[model samples]
Target chain A: MLSTKEIKQSIRSISSIKQITRAMEMVAASRLKKVESRVLASRAYTERMQQVLSHLASSIPSERSHPLFTQKESVPVIKIVLITADKGLCGAYNNNIIQTTAKFIKENTGNTIKLIHIGKKGNLYFSKGGYTIEKYYPENVEKFGYNQVKTLASQLIDGYEAGEFGQLHIFFTKFKTTMQYSPTSIRLLPIEKDAIKTKVIAKGEYIFEPSAEQIIEHLFPKYIETQIYQCILESLTSEYAARRVAMIAATENAGEMIDELTRSYNKARQETITKELLEVISGAEALIKG
Target chain B: MAKTFKIEVITPEKVVYDDTVQSITAEGTEGSFGVLADHASMIAELQTGILTISDVNNKTVRFALDGGFVEILANNVIVLTDTCTKEGEVDVEKAMAEKASAEKALLKVGSGVEKEKAKAALKRANTLLKLANK
Candidate 1:
């Protein structure tokens, strides 16, 4: 049996761990609130942009094809954009993305797939793998800014225009609710007609400012950029939520562990005291008999 | 006495302006255009310039927008811009400094992509300076 002193040391260590987990839980909760609100606020702007894009897509006939809208005939190389969190302790947030990318690569063996990592976790995970990593964005999920988004978008646009890749897809975890998140894969290029279906077609009388062709060439890239930025924001929010939930569970588990350890420690101490009392009584009895 | 349309200007960060305005004068790529209520449903690509909105009460609000798209649909105006700042938000000293730097860059760059980028920066800086001074 372990001594009372040893048990006391173990309990003390567990208590400190519990304290750390509790603090982390609180931090994640507060950060999640701020990130969630930011994601919610940007919803309106994204919706409006999608609406305009859908309208434009419906108005323009399919025969007149823009570079962003036209799909190549041959089997084309695919670029997969992986978004993950910078830090760990988020309970499978990064693992899900990495594993998903791995599974996607496994299934699409025939096609040439290049990985574009957004967060540190993804870059770290994919860098060792045999798959070709095209680019890794250095910005952390929490520090994502408009300029970064613009730069990423422009690079992708230029690459697609230069025929670097035939298709592009972004993989991220969609924040569905506080407790649930799902890995979602969205196609970013080629702007398929069905992908942008208009809700209420603009009466066929909508005018384009500098003509339809120029607007399509100009506007579609911006739409894609906005979509990508929204995905990043959503992914960040989900990461915080996942971390908060995971930390809460961890803290509670630690509390339970501490309780169990304290009970055992108290029992060990009581047993030691009882043994000493018995020994002292025997010694007193022996002296009286002599 | 004047018809009003709902106008909302949004950036990636937040919604900068949302209100009922009598008319909006924005600088499009082609040229300057004034949009009133019940204007035909259309989309105009905006340039780096002042976006003037006249409220129903005849009060004018000017915002410096650094390139975006404007969509007019059923009397609702939604402006999606990269950078947006009102007259009250702009810092004159900072804008002047930016304008000077952008002008210098424009002069230093030779012909081609860098020059085009520098020119665009200069235009955006000029727009900010105009709004700050106003």
Candidate 2:
């Protein structure tokens, strides 16, 4: 029952909203393309790395010397790198990560904990609350490459090697599909012996060129770096997918509103025209009677 | 001739190369070594240098290896490392800058082990640059 003026104004506002959403959707789509390609390209590297590591673990009879491969105690202190988007309007993307991470952290509070925060949103919320954030990286997740990730990876690996932490955790929203994203926390460090897929190529007759200790000591940090890079890729892909979906939904909703408003505006316009027409006819009829 | 095997060069970001190569020439910790079709089981302590692989066409594909290890066994060679770039992909200016910075760090820090690491980094960057640009 809205007046024509009111209906027109509503339609104008809805159209503006739709325009903004459509713009946002285009931007998200561009970012999604890059991150998704990176993930796809790196999957081959990940598989081959797994193959090499499995081969080494099975061939070598002794334990790994690097701190990352060692699992100590019944309960190990875990360091978690939580990646969340900076802005809002992504629809439960941040909420999902925060909830899952909070639960995990609270339960593991009895053990030592450290957090690596990637986005401003998570840093602000966790810092405001009582969570102790060990490090915060404010870099643009969209432009991530191997060099930056290696630096961070080296820092963590160095810390672990220095006996700073026992375990590593990574939390992020996983991009399942365009319509679905699930916040997941995964163990990132300490390539467990049982978890290895590739078996050692040479068992007893293997010869370590310079020395066994030196070769393993070198490959450990690289392994850490590769793992972290994969996580960053996943998190970025999830962000884009989430944002794109959110924008699309908004645009569709705006379209529905526009349809409703157009109908209302038409009804109001017809009523106004009919009223004016009837008034003229009545006035003419009155004039004739007079 | 022996059957061809896969040689995959994997870095942290992505796979640099994955093709069936005839041989691998890499700088091992002890010395530079080449792996043919029937190589012995060897774990190489990788230093920073140029890694060259001979394709089936006998053409050489060179990759600048930063610091990591190379494992040659069963003819399946895996070069795992922190940084890797092909000859066509290397940035010479950047590598020179890295070498200079590492040298500067070495000069400032006199700690024996760290200085050695810095020295190694400089050598790696310089050698990779030389091999890549050549």
Give the TM-scores of the predictions, in the order they appear. Answer: 0.86, 0.81
Candidate 2: where are CA atoms >4 Å away? A54-66, A74-76, A106-113, A124-130, A138-151, A162-164, A175-182, A195-205, B12-14, B38-42, B57-59, B81-134
- For model 1, residues A1-290, the per-residue Cα lDDT tens digits are 88878888888898898899889989988988988888877877887887777677667777965667667535468888888999999998889978887898889887899988889999998888587999887877777776787888888888888888888889998888889988888777865456443444544456888777887777777787788888898899899899989989998998898898888988998998999999999999999999
Chain B TM-score, all predictions listed: 0.94, 0.86
Q: How much lDDT does candidate 1 score?
A: 0.84
Q: Write the per-residue lDDT of candidate 2 for residues A139-257, one digit (tens) a residue.
A: 76666667888898888878777777777888988766767778887675666555543443423357787866665666666666666777777777888888898999999999999
Docking quality level of the chain pair in candidate 2: acceptable
Q: Candidate 2's C-alpha lDDT?
A: 0.78
Clashing pairs in model 2, backbone N/Cα/C closer than 3 A: A54-A198, A55-A198, A55-A199, A55-A200
> Chain A TM-scores, all candidates?
0.92, 0.86
Question: What are the RMSDs of all candidates, in order?
Answer: 3.2, 4.1
Question: Per-residue error at B126 for model 2, in Å?
Answer: 5.5
